[model samples]
Target chain A: MAITVIPRGDVPLGQEHEFFKFVCPPTFGGGPVDAQPATIKFARKLDVMADLPLPAGVKTYNGGNSLRLWLIADPNDSSSNGATFPAKTIRTKKGDVVWVDTGFSFNTHTIHWHGIEPTPMNDGVGHTSFEVSGNFTYQFATNTAGTYIYHCHKNTVLHFIMGLYGLFVVDPPQGPKFAAANAPGAFGFDPVNFSVPIDVEAAWVPGEFDSIWNDLGHNAFMQKCDQNDPAGAGTFTQNGFLNRFRPDIVHITGVVSVPGNPITDPRVSVAAKTNQNILVRLVHAGYTVQEYTLGLDATVIGEDGHPLGVPPFDKYSFPFVIPANTPFRLTSARRYDLLLNSPNAGVFPFQVKFMDWINGTVYQTAQTTVTVV
Target chain B: MKRRDFVKVGLAGMSAVVVGSMEIPPLFRCVARAANLAFDMSFTEALVEMIDKTQVYHWLFSADAGFATTGPSLPGPTIIATYGDKITINFTNNLPQPHGFRIVGTSIGTGVIPNVNKAPANKFTLTFTAPPPGTYLYIDPFYEPVNRILGLHGAFISLPKGGNTPYGGKTTPNVQQLFNDLGSTPQFPGDPWLPPPANRSLIWLFHQVDPWFNARAQAGIFINPDTLKAKFLPRYFLISGKTGAFASDVPNISIVGNIGEPHLIRILNAGLANHSPHLHANHFYVLSKNLVVQNNVLNIDTFTVGPLDTVDWLVPMIRPPDIPGLKSTPLRQLIPHELTTVLYTLQSPLMYPMHCHMEMSQTAAGGNYPQGLITHMIFTGDVDKVPFPV
Candidate 1:
């Protein structure tokens, strides 16, 4: 565990207590553990560093200084401060019965839940089971309700690009209501009537940060192999430059975005009002190939966590529409959801881009804004 | 290669088989059978062989002499068609440079088809008309993606004109026989793999090989699409073109099936990274992505086919939800009653694996860990003892 650089301008620029936010703790909040089984915990937080704020002629890769671990949902308080970089947003509900726990501490992580489907020793998948080192829990039973993602399956490509993920969502048990004031909230899954009212939710996610593997450390190119050495523990190799993925830096839910500008981060912009609705969600936590582009007219309805046209999958699938200034892509860990609404009111411009998995080359783009009113 | 023997070896000169008891007068038997097809192909330059055997070179696609008798093929065959057929193709350019072709989500030849000379005057053709039904890729759109990652590309499919469901029209609702009757249950019996008048349809495609960018495009050199995102290094991860351990010992990249059938795979991420495959024991049903459809399909076990996407899934070869099921009430009271009485008396053929959670495509030349883009989904009760090469 030794690669802690932090010396480029001795880390300064916009610290904001290194982006705080922990809150939840009431043994996982929401009165009476939302009726019975809940658990939650989290607690991993190693090394850590957030800062972010780029946008004015954006140039990252260690300057927007990331290097993270997070997960801290108030793991027994100690003044909380897990320093978020995208390790919050869990929000359960639909059927509930969670567990999660996690814990860890130094090097062995796990927490998968990417599209949930529990059971494989609670499916955190560290070689199909076991990797938590100190804690584990994970139980599961959220039963469908869209948009998920929860990273850190051990060295999952440098711990999900060194920021062990977040955003698991779920909702639908008529909880987190949205559309304030004019009433109506609910959100996702409306196969004719389960909920989907919305009134602005957002989410985005969109990652990408390759500050040379964020200054390498947590077992960067792991090695240890012998099997009676004869130059063949599968032909041993060193470094191999951790499969070269040069993303200078591009954020979007963790903010940063300065390639072409416009991420006036009011939590990545959105506002709303015209005809209300909204929703977004997205996900694609970077490994490249993002695309996006929207400007309204979305509709997708759900994916990666179900809810599309509903019923026995609406005979075979439905919730389509992707009109306005189109584009659409998403790759690594893909998740969609969409929904938007805008009948008349302005602003729009979603964007994203980030490409380069190989040929589709739009290095970085980001942008944000939705406004409407 | 049994996707109907790779569509009878990439459509043997468009073998016009019509036969649904061909009397077709009863009001054009609900009309829908355009059929025309054609073929030829070529764009050669081979070398192939890499399931650790090495070799390399590439620039594929070759059915040539009016189809069948194939040769150069990394991902260069498959084609098929139906939804209003018509097609064509022809091609030629035996490699040395200029290429073309296109296809991606069709609309009558959608441009390219160029070929710029190599064999005499090279040749070209293309044509079109098979849009609607879904899945399409065809590539070699010349240089961008280095002539489709130095191996051209393939898969066109289309289907659905009673090709037993994969997309609407023809009274829809087959949903592959309702997901092969949820894995043909009587506590799971076989029968599910349907498509093309009932069975066999897999086409995975997904490729990777970056042998130093195909040995600098096999010596002609020239790359520089701005240093190809910093010297693109792939190290072999394929599917149709098979990779390490012969990518699950072939049958079109490891996918046997029997215990309650359920196959219909069709993945197609003509490589450039971003995979996320994962498919341990069961959980599959995604049904459509690039060709649209997919409204809340779900049942996932990891899905994220990126670069030039196109997923389709169905996999439900049933049974393995951590086994344990003879009759266990209340989700077996949440497991662990001595491991659900020892996994409820185990059974069937099993196998599993289906790798690529993007952990560096499960490694290959950069340390052969599971030999890149791994495979295997057997489940066999006896898919002819799971070996297919004929």
Candidate 2:
């Protein structure tokens, strides 16, 4: 039976809407992920892997503001021939629309989305319009299709550093082949609802911030003066998807000292337990397009947020495209989710490279890992 | 004629014309112009002397004493007055250790004051006739650690200077001059209506610690004793007070944690040592430093809390969950209570620093005292914002 991959969506809410309930079943002590079945089940609790809660709060959007995108899934992704799997990929259109409901306090943001052409009002920018803080909805649609980035276009001292940025992808030239009567039976599906991004931007990798000399321009920020984050991961572990609510400060005065912050953010451990084989809708949100190598050797079953014909991430030059300043973000909370199936446990690492044709290195964060069962 | 003859003629003609009339700037003229703009903004620390070493202490008055670094060292007397009456302090010292002060308020009016090892005792005592209504501090070069420590640091008690007048900044000036007044004539300054760290009609002392470099380095460098051994290594980590400020509390001084009520603790690191001093819960702000305090500092849960750092915290602020609608389960409030307060503000509950900044300093003979290297901005009664309902 062909399988599928995407973020388990619509994390159901409790009647009382307790803050803790909405939070990822906290790492270790966190209680539960109230998401619907798909979002709630923790990658099949197995003893081989430690059970961890997923940091949570799915993307919410307001009405009037809407998002449109293609949802593609993969049955057998190439990156996972080595990984145990019952996985699938979800794909989006050349121009997809996602919405943002300024329904909550943290939702107040200006959308700096990449890859598509959005109507001025739908596009998330303060200069163009007002901020969608509470129940106000903002809509956006992507026209420039390629891997891109999105973030709150607000006056952020460091919003992205506060873990605000997300990667988005558009339609790749090649995509998944949905089952048709000509060949297969109606395929079963995995319950991931949203398009999740799995861009391996070192910031989420499980490794200590050993420094990436490859990102030449940033070498100065990584000089030998050390804080032994490697010898011990301490309470801080760089891994998995970040939190949609809180933000982790990434740099201070240009220094790349991971764990060099409010010490340990509980989000990492939280994200570890809740979600699984979720779509890592990859996008290029940085100034330069990156050569994001999942340092953990993840198989690429999908490209540009879409499942490919045969997933090996075989499309080398099919660059994850993000135009310089295009506002290609979601209108109705629509996001491009990547398809993944990581049966392997523990934090899987990844290295991000800003492949700027200028013969250089990719700036990186402490290696982040996505713990899976 | 040769072309050479023509060239010589043109040159001679141009030279004669120029010499007779044209007045263009010369290279040296440009150099001189630049030189005129070049200003070597020098500074210096205060220096006290016994002349005979027989005098118990030499009194300093701001009016007579030049408390700036770019001019004289022991230039004059103390600028003295009552607690509430405002005053101006002017100084000059063309040496090093740019002078600074450690008073409280808006971080303005910080000129070159001295922080020298040989500071005048009482730093040229400006005995306030009385104490101000609130806690106040005054030092030279108001922004750093070295200048605020050692002998340069002093306290100001602005009590009812005139008929027990309370703190209304608008009260009439006091007539009584506390201890020493350099003179009745005002020193070099203007009005006190300006912002903080600057007060007209105030006292100024110099907290000078010679070898300012050591204290300055402590704030920046991390000493890994594991990597460097004593006597065998050249990197001396000792700053201000020569030795043991971090290892030992100020000798003979017993600092109290919490009195009867919520206490307000003000820790100033105007010395040379980079101190990762932690207190029990209570967020703090680095009020003034670098001679000017910027508004850059907001509510800080825990900071490096280093040299030249000034933190003012309220001890009695309530722990949350004490009010209605807010979750106040003991476990829930534990972390914030522990990390955010003065007692174990940084631990996991009340959340104190699991590991202090400079992580290395958190240890003594390889073990943490938790209390020794730690402090508390303790609260006493009626915790202010406890969010849980009865």
Candidate 3:
């Protein structure tokens, strides 16, 4: 079993610690390396300083959205190769041991692996399990082959929006069974053998941030909990804790060129030869509902880490064809792995659409594209 | 994808095509086949004070939905019907503000309206096809965030057509099961693949209210939606409108049930926050969620019920009498692991404290902890004093 130890932190990690203390100032139960960091971030910082330079093609919203994430450092790699936000794409074979060290410099955070059935102790929910303050090692064996989500469990309403998340993909071991199932020779079935496919692959982690929630330290908004209408709008008391969750910017793969700037939003790229299959893993870490439409015909091979139509789970899982125009809806923290077969060389965009939860209305679309030549 | 486009694409067609691949058992399986039944109901506005004396200006359903009398109750009573029954509720809104109702589950009817006040003081005759027996929710869809919190929701249950037994198949006909009979063993002795049968079924419609909103609305003050969003902290957590908001009243807390009979605890979280309900002595088996039976019922000491989620568990009082159908020896002898029996069968009836694991929910409005959302499962000295109302 391969043991992969991944450390979670942010780029210019040192600056994030400074910023966290500055906004949450020690007075309001926030400071450098405070014990109860998750619940004690700055109350309200309408304007925050961007101590770190913006990544190429990335912009900020609301005095700059401050939460920059990175999953860096492979303990196995002695070299200086380390963590970066939209943390390095985690790829592993089934049965490999993944030892995730959640060493957050500021605030408390727990890593909840969406759709992965880890023990309750390993299930990183703040209230359910102990939240990691400084550093804690979470060890688990990847048993299922599918695209899964990983995000901070502390103060889910806020922490998830603050951009502490990534995707975890476990690949099934290749074998005779896998080869037969994904045989390209099967007529009209250029199946991208997900079990050990000889094809290109890309992982799309679709998420958004509420500019306001990310700008202020968690403590600032939490400070307003159960208080009178500070906003003075007066409809009723504000539930700062209730997750009003109005995000201004949406991006893919943790590369937000600018908050509220979806125009230059990034899309994952993959190349495959004509008639070759490309595997696309669509995963969600954001809090709202997302619907995705594949530009080309694709077969859904797995969902939530289970092989479609496999025994026992066949009662639930089944391989369904996504007709060219049909869309697959994903609630918060859902994953779908699809194999896209390209008959012609061109760009195939997966239109990831967002909706307003209060009213079932499609509001926006974020695109992730794959090009085959 | 646009909403209209999504609807056009095949919301209804998708389910039909998917079900063709597999055979899902009929929702509720009962032995006693019954004919379709219908009922009429209405909503009336009332200023009722909760257990903590916090007055809420809310809409309540009158006990008799029989077309004439209107007396609103806290958690409008449960609407019980048999599978394949047709429930037609004539919900007349008598409040100053607009109100409407919708029954969720099954495709019997389209009972949703975007706005209840589109027609001033309207009366909506909603229809529902009740099949696939399970617990369902009927809430005020309009301003649900506001109206539901103001106490405008109720429970709806559809029993299998003719069977007193839930999920009837393997066991004897006298045994009434809640869902399908997966069949049971001496170890389970109740529902197959589930816990022992409960003699009494209790519904705990969990809800919470922000006292500040209740006070503001009661004073006839206008509340701004944005401001309301800013101060939305729910302090008063309740189970069926009990659990006083003060620690001193803990002794007189509402009773969950008495010992000797396994209690089917139906827990529904209508509030915004997730509730981790922790039972004291006896761990329960989560039999079903919403109304869908699980492949294998899970045994848990504390489980979370998220907002708008429903969970049903059998809080077994003891090792039930091993019956003929369980296919195993009667569990007359206690094993070392059977601690649930030792604690419950103590010489004197005991009160086991059960509360929310979130900790904050058990507090008073002013941040006093251990005041709200806490109760006890009472074990009576004599089995005759079974606490629940049949």
Candidate 4:
């Protein structure tokens, strides 16, 4: 099976233009936009290629497809930028209702707001509801301010690996500057001036790509979706390679992290001034369990979009700080918001060890530095 | 019907319904006034039937006095102790190989017991003071994941000293009152079926079984612990050693509660692979992870539980989030009224699934979808009043 880009003519008339405009409206200025039940349009891109040029070899595959939402609106800009591996991050504010308009396109796909709890109809689990064969608007309100994710829930195992997901962050009403302030005891940061309490936010979504699975066609395992063969009784001639997952390439937040080289992707390898609070939103977007070891002491304040130690929740639990060098683990779909403040200036490496699920053996280790100037 | 009768009806004709037997009594007894408690446990082997009727060999921890009887189960037995109580387990290894017991998240008896080969030596006594008030995993530390995964793991719950509340001072809403407020009377009035407010808890011990590993162990094939040569492809996923339709029927796996009440679900990922347990009907408040109380409690429908990680969730048994109500958000309006208000009435007793979000865990025997790591959270009310199917 080879990668085939859907011709522009094949798309529904005026969809690419209208939806693209809705995604990146003329009013979008890189800041948080009011979701006042906003209609955020997204069109599926199939057979999108991601080429990683590593020192050892140049690994390439169209295993990735972005939910061309608000981040990338230009239909002509189809280049596989490292930043666009997983669809660009969708940022919104609390109390905002986001109507994700997944426009009609190729094979059936549903965008599931991973951690957010919306109505079942909008939840995007095709088995529970109906798969979006045509245009469907998933509606959900951002009730909580925390880090989240959105991905295609159709044939999730394959669709997720195909890179049809991205970070979905809901900021507090005070916006991005106050994102870290949501944590208990988070003070001394000035969100207005963005100076004394400079917040260096970095989203690290570490994922692994199995080149074999990536090379397969988009409908490689469509037979499994046969409704008639609910019990999997029907004999499908193709080998069930979906069960066998062996990842060869590892990437950190879309940028491929070569074994011996420093990940210089500005989005991942972040820069911060001394005394600046570095808030790292770590989302484990891979199949394997990930163990993250940070060079600086991190006060973990949130998990799965809930700020730790915040009111109502604080009645039952409180946030605890993890000492530097201590490793913490996260499974797929787990998000942890860590607030790190460095008093001294130095280059600190944040390492992620992707291990086999059965045994805690590091299959791959990807590193991104937190350069505190 | 009485609670016991309800249990009998719910578990009728199910061969795997081991509740009300020796395996379940200890889990519900949260208030242990005794200063010290002693249990006679044996490490034995058994053939447990899966949902697909596949009889799988397992090494389990049985709460039997001796290994003379074949009473061992897939998940051993739940050991519950009040905070500050001394727990003494007279553990006997009935299996051919040496097995050891150690509690994760507790301070006492942290070391693995030495190999018990001879008669007197095989029967080892382990005494440990119940650490803090939280949930813990008691497993055979021998060979690490190999021994633990083979069914030698169980839940060790340390109840709060003063009361049923997990944190001692906190209090949950009255379940019976909540049900009454929702216009339903208790099916078994004055019956001691429901735990006291804030004391209702369920243990979900998530585990996956690899048949090849079990077969190898049964054949006496030595598996190197440091370097596992066999690829781990678990075919069966279990919640407290139960799966598929059988899991939801088990009183221990499926959560049954009244409207507006809270049920604390103590979830332990005993499997090697990570699991994301997704709950329907209502989102749960993540109270703590790995015995540490979470400062930022998140109300989420799905949360991740990594290998060997223990998470405590407080399930607020309210109306389903998608249900149309006066407080429905703007997004809720998008859902058709038939699917919301018209379909499910407030008096309806609804049942929703609590399944693993990890796509592969939804399968058993490799490709049997919806046959693994699935259970239910049922709200108790007047079921006949419900006009539509839930």
lDDT winner: 4
Per-residue lDDT tens digits of candidate 2, residues B134-234? 33444554333333332344333233332321233422222011011112213201111211212111111112222223233234343232222211111
> What tens digits encode model 3's per-residue C-alpha lDDT throughout B19-39?
222211111111222354445
Model 2: per-residue Cα lDDT at residue B356:
24
TM-score of chain A, model number 4: 0.78
Clash totals for all candidate models? 1, 167, 48, 8
Instruction: Evaluate model 4: give its lDDT.
Output: 0.61
Clash pairs (backbone) in predicted model 4: A301-A308, A307-B296, A308-B295, A308-B296, A309-B295, A309-B296, A318-B295, A319-B295
The deviation in Å at residue A10 for candidate 2 is 63
User: For model 1, what is the alpha-carbon lDDT of residue B390?
Assistant: 19
- Per-candidate RMSD, Å: 26.1, 28.6, 16.2, 11.2
Ranking by lDDT: 4, 1, 3, 2
How high is the DockQ of candidate 1?
Answer: 0.06
Per-prediction DockQ comes to 0.06, 0.02, 0.02, 0.11
TM-score of each: 0.32, 0.26, 0.56, 0.72
Candidate 4, A253-366: lDDT as tens digits: 878777877788897898988878778888888877788998988887677777654443222334468898899887777788888888899998889888765555677788
Query: Candidate 1, TM-score vs. the true structure?
Result: 0.32
Q: Which has the greatest DockQ?
A: 4
Worst 10 residues of 1 chain A by lDDT: A17-26
Worst 10 residues of 2 chain B by lDDT: B26-35
What would the per-residue lDDT of candidate 1 be over residues B1-390, giving only the tens digit for each residue?
222232232222123233222211110111122488777777777776564445678787776544434455667767766777787777777655777778776544434443445445677787767878877777876566777887788887777765445774632354554554653445344564566644556667788877887888778788875575456678767776664343543344556654456677788877667677867556577767888765445555677787788888877665453322222332223343312221111111233456766566655555434446766665434322332221
- Candidate 3 overall Cα lDDT vs. reference? 0.48
**Candidate 4 per-residue lDDT over residues B91-175, each given as its tens digit:** 7777778888888866554344444457666777878888887778878877877888888887887777664347554333432
